[model samples]
Target: MTKLNCPFCYNTIRRRSELHFMCRGRPTGARPACQPELDQVRSNLTGFKEATLPTFEAVSENLMLPFTKAHCPKCGGETTTRACSHCHTRLPMEFGLDASPMVAMVGARGTGKTVYLTVLSNELQKPKIRSEFAATVRPIGEGQDGFGAQDQWVRESIHQVYEDRKLFSTTAQAVDGRKAPIVLEWRGRHNRRFVLRKFRTNYLSFYDTAGEDLTADDVTFKLHYLRAADYLILLLDPFQLPEVQRLLRLPPAALLHVREGKPPIDVLARVTEALKQGDHWNGRHITVPVAVAFAKMDAFNQHLPETHPLRARRRTLGGYDEKTGRIIHEEMKSLLHEWGGDEIDAHLSGHYRSYQYFAVSALGAEPDYENYLVNPRGVRPDRVEEPLLWLMHKGGLVPRAAS
Candidate 1:
């Protein structure tokens, strides 16, 4: 009996023995068709107010019994689509029964969370990344072959950034305005114990939010997912750092796109405060593994030499490279102190039991600010895959040695 958290609702899911199912819809061998109706619970949690397949709960008298399958009461057909008992949001059974780690993506506005996430998902599915891990990636949501809201939302976001050359505009506050999460199953012959299991399939969920959503006391309960996360990917925009600001000679148009906000330390402190309020980490130090990444490293290219680890173009990482990971981690740490962000590193050291720093650029080159488009050289993603990969390594989904 694995205890899992609903990535969408942040509610504890009693898996295997207690099961919830949603109708697949339509008639089935004498079974009635399920009509789409308003699922208020899901709507309240996800802001997905549109009518959806109804979900119902079932529990076995025998606690040890594996209650894997259920029939829709409205329809007599066997339904395999499982949903959260609390919010009625459909979730993959792979995660429900297997207990998977959840990673929350956090960053202030202008950190390019949307852009980085888009590129990361794209890179994971590309041949370069897929072949290295011997992995298969599939988005898990309504419909088949990556259909439904999750796939469509990611598709559109990817198209906008990679094809249209325009970055995602500032995210709007509220559940409805945020980007739908990138949820999927990462099945592969990877993981540290691959020699034993031979293969492992992991269901991963990446959740992001508008910068405005963090640090507010009012949102403490509304954003409970942060506390429930097993791992976190914290992104920091170098442009926001005062030291970077004083040094960079960015164009006025580029500066216009930057969101005015507090230093990264304030963001980290507020998140720490919120985690303290949670039941799990009510202490000074938190146990969640965090990948603290400095996004948009391209903005500082002129300041760095070719030998800088951040500028090294990666061809393919057949697997997680611990040596390279360590080099970049230390480089970012030293750079933080140089940029007056040692406080950010200090806060993590004092408050986090485990964390790693990284330097990444979603777009390998700075976008043409005056033209309001991606770099003319196009969207050359650089090291956008490291943060999530590190979290995956911690989750035991991928091996530590690069092949």
Candidate 2:
């Protein structure tokens, strides 16, 4: 009886005894769109005209009865798929029956969020990792004829980072020009039980926007999808830490060259304001788990002691080590304080009731720029999946154990 959230519109669908259906094909005539909200979503994803939108009609007349399929009332054509009752968008095969976790990745510019996402996707698709987790992750709406803009962007991004070993360009800053959010479907069974009960599917949607868009004053209205996220991963760039920049002798030119957008504190404040507006935190701590991770840790790995928890690499994947996660969390918090990021630490602690810290390096080593291309030594990610694994464990989707 779990509640399902529409990946496109972020509308919550309550559990019901009977199933509902919506037409999959576009309306033949000018019957008028039944769901204007869904039409807006379609228009945002694709440049389709609202007047030529598909219409939805409920197939079942009784709430306690089951309907295998239905016909579009407008065209009299049969439909074999199901859709969200609130929004007419087609639902995944068994969407309403399983759990779907919406994850949002947010950070200031040059925080390595895009690189982290690219590497994380590659890591999740690895044979050994998928075998250990007993899951298969793939992008949604990829094969569909109508919706392909967002899917194409994801494919290009992954190919660039994993195949070509090159970095992606800066995210588009204009709200209207930005691509749609990347949505993925993770289908697998639980690792705890041996006997087969029923296979479960979880939909994971990611929203990656330009760092400038997040810092804008009108972000609350622009990025309304943040309100529907089940988990938040806030990436903090090591180069932005004033103490780290000074200790490493990183020149002003280097900082300016990388387009260091805004301080992490300011970006986080803007995110907090948006969350408050959504009633996520009403003068109280928010329930959504936040992972405050230090991206580009490879650049600063030399500064840490040999015995530092972050220096160790994770080997197994069936379950997370709670004790080890806590150790790293505390170590990262201490490092932030020493790096003159105590204000950022304080802000997170005050607003989020449940939060943890992590350190990750997407490239495993700093890339050398030559002839306008980077990563001459090739790319090897180090512990890039740790944050995702931690979130899965916290949500009880994966097991947790002490090291």
Candidate 3:
């Protein structure tokens, strides 16, 4: 029994000890179907108003070993469906049995966090990447092999980014019900020679908060998930770099996308402070691994030398490459120094015990900002999944490259 924070509500709980379940709703002559009710706890946390299947705690005899399947208190029907104790969102059947790593994504406004998240999720579903990583990124809501998630938050995101070939609207603030963490099941095959092939399934909970939500100290501190996160994806806007912004000249329309906010280092400091606000951290350097990525690389890649490490593809194969990972880490660190963002590298080094730098472009090419459409070349994603792949490698969800 391991303890984990519920991805939806961000509350810590022992997996088996705090179990709650939902009714399957199969009506029988003996027991009628359960009625839907307004779950206030769920409505408050998720902003979902619609009444749903009744959820109840399982009554069991043994405290050491809890019941996996029990007769529903409401319907008298046997059900195994699990729900989070705090938020009541449906948990996957495999959730309590496996490791569900929380990856908290945060950055300032105008960093293109939504676009990057959309493209990254779309890229991870491609066959080439799937074959290489020996895994599939499936939405937790879908809970099936064929159709996509029933949650419109994801359906609409995919439609806007992949189907319509346009950038999706900015992610709504944390209070907005339309925004939810794109919870996923990273199911994979752990193949090893001279051994049994194991089913290695892991959960990935990515909550992409609105940039404005993290700008103020009070608001950022209230987001306790930052402290509970197993990993952090800190996205930085390239245009915010004074040196980089002045060096590149863009059309008037594209300029509309840039907006001023706290500096990148200042944003990192706020997040680091939030992580320290926890009981255990005490303002000391935290051990959580961070993947600090500069999103929208298209703005910089075109002007930099073609051979620059950031512009070149570092990951083209299946497993994680430690050698290339380090190379790019250093390359991006130096590039930051050149862009007058050395304080960012220093701040990360001082605050986080482990951190890596990456350059990712959700759209491989810059979009037509005025028309709200992708480039004429379409949304060709460049290394959008590299940060996640590296994080996966760190978690042992994927293998280390063999020489």
Q: Estimate each model's TM-score.
A: 0.90, 0.86, 0.91
Model 1: per-residue Cα lDDT at residue 102:
74
State the displacement of the C-alpha of residue 79, model 3, in Å, after optimal TM-score superposition. Answer: 1.1
* lDDT tens digits by residue: candidate 1, 105-183: 8887667888888888777778777787898776665466213777888778778888888876777775633334567
RMSD of candidates 1 onward, in order: 3.1, 4.1, 3.1
Q: Give the TM-score of candidate 2.
A: 0.86
Ranking by TM-score: 3, 1, 2
Writing each residue's lDDT as its tens digit, candidate 3 over 1-403 gives 4447776766776755476888778786687888777789887876656677777886784567657876777678777888888878777776765567889898887688888877777777789877887777867757341113334566678778777887765656877322357777788875545535376567788888787777777888778778778888999887788788778776666555455466777788888888887753646777778899988888886678888877664664768878778888888888789889988877888778888988888888888877789888778888788788788788767787764
Indicate which candidate wins on lDDT: 3
- Which pairs, if any, clash in model 3? none
Best-first order by lDDT: 3, 1, 2
Off by over 4 Å in 2: 15-41, 44-55, 61-65, 85-87, 174-179, 191-197, 251-254, 257-260, 305-307, 313-316, 369-372
Better of 2 and 3 by lDDT: 3
How much does candidate 1 score in TM-score? 0.90
